[model samples]
Target: MKYIKIKRVMDFIFSLILLIVISPIMLCAAVAIKCGGQGPVLFKQERPGKDGVIFTIYKFRTMRLETEKDGHPLSDMERMTRVGMMLRKLSIDELPQLLNILRGNMSFIGPRPLLIQYLERYTPEQMRRHDVTPGISGWAQINGRNGIDWETRFEYDLWYVKNISFLTDLKIFLGTLAVILGTRGVNQSKSQTMEEFGVATKSLKG
Candidate 1:
């Protein structure tokens, strides 16, 4: 109880400080996004958070809106603009999530919130990830991020949830910084981002 309260306080304080420090960079990112192409400056999507609650997650728009000859949307790589590519490489596109942290919709450290549509796809054990607030970075992210398989990712998330502590969060936070600086595991092979978890096998009932 004490730790949870302390962590929440730390999250609030750090989020505010970082928001102030990164305002200029965020403004620059917004302008760059506008100059890159047409579309909203921010991309908002509903994601499952702590206790399976849903919240709108915010990110800087990094893809151009376009349709194919069949009127279907193009792949993420196809829609990625030059500036978008740069922003993604530097992870500047994730800065908007600071607002989520400020709103208490997220934490600085926890399992990364996944799409809401995946709720029914999770196995009973996997569903434990929602036991804590989602985060901009997590044990899974710092481990192998998009480079790992879904099973491994969930295992890492569960591990973090079961062993969450100040020291653990600090290690994951620092590891995230290293991963971002190295620009590692930003995307999976043959995809601009990690693939979504669609319908799960019937054997692994949610």
Candidate 2:
């Protein structure tokens, strides 16, 4: 329990420092988005946080405003702008989440927050990932990110929940740097992002 408190302090202090250090990069990203003719510089979405609490997660907008193109709905890749793609590739899009970290809505490491719709879909075991604050990068992220299947990803998240500690977080942080530099697992093998959890089947588990 003390480490949890320590982790929150670390999240707050480091996120504050990182935000200040990265302000210029965030500004450049914002300008690029605006110049790209996108509707907004930032994308805001509701995500389930710790204990399934609802909170807004922020990222640099990475897709076009229009849902449809030339009479058909646009795929995520189709909607992605050149600048947006660059931002995503460099992981610049996630810098704004430092604010979420500062606000105590998230941590630097834990289970990545997921869509609000997913709150009801998780198995009781899977829902334990929400016992800690959501994070920008976590055990699942360093393991495989969007590249892995939902079951595997949830397994990693639960592992982190059970073994969260300074060393665990440090390992994830180091691995994240490698992942970003390598740009592996940023997207699914065949999709811009992974498919929605439990979408193909009626339930995750019988």
- By lDDT, the best candidate is 2
lDDT of 1: 0.87
Question: Model 1: runs farther than 4 Å from truth?
Answer: 67-73, 199-206
TM-score of 2: 0.96
Name the candidate that leads on TM-score.
Answer: 2
The positional error of residue 116 in candidate 1, measured at the CA in angstroms, is 0.6
After superposition on all CA atoms, how large is the RMSD of candidate 1? Answer: 1.8
Q: Write the per-residue lDDT of candidate 1 for residues 1-206, one digit (tens) a residue.
A: 58888988889999999999999999999998898777999999999999998899999998877755387767777778888888887889988898999899999999999988788888889999999889999999999988887878889999999999999999998998899889888887554477656433344443
Clashing pairs in 1: none
**Per-residue lDDT of model 2, residues 32-119, tens digit only:** 8999994978999999999998999999999899989779987777788989878877899999999999999999999999888887
Q: Give the least accurate 10-residue stretch of model 2, judged by summed lDDT.
A: 197-206
lDDT of each: 0.87, 0.89
Q: What's the TM-score of every candidate structure?
A: 0.93, 0.96
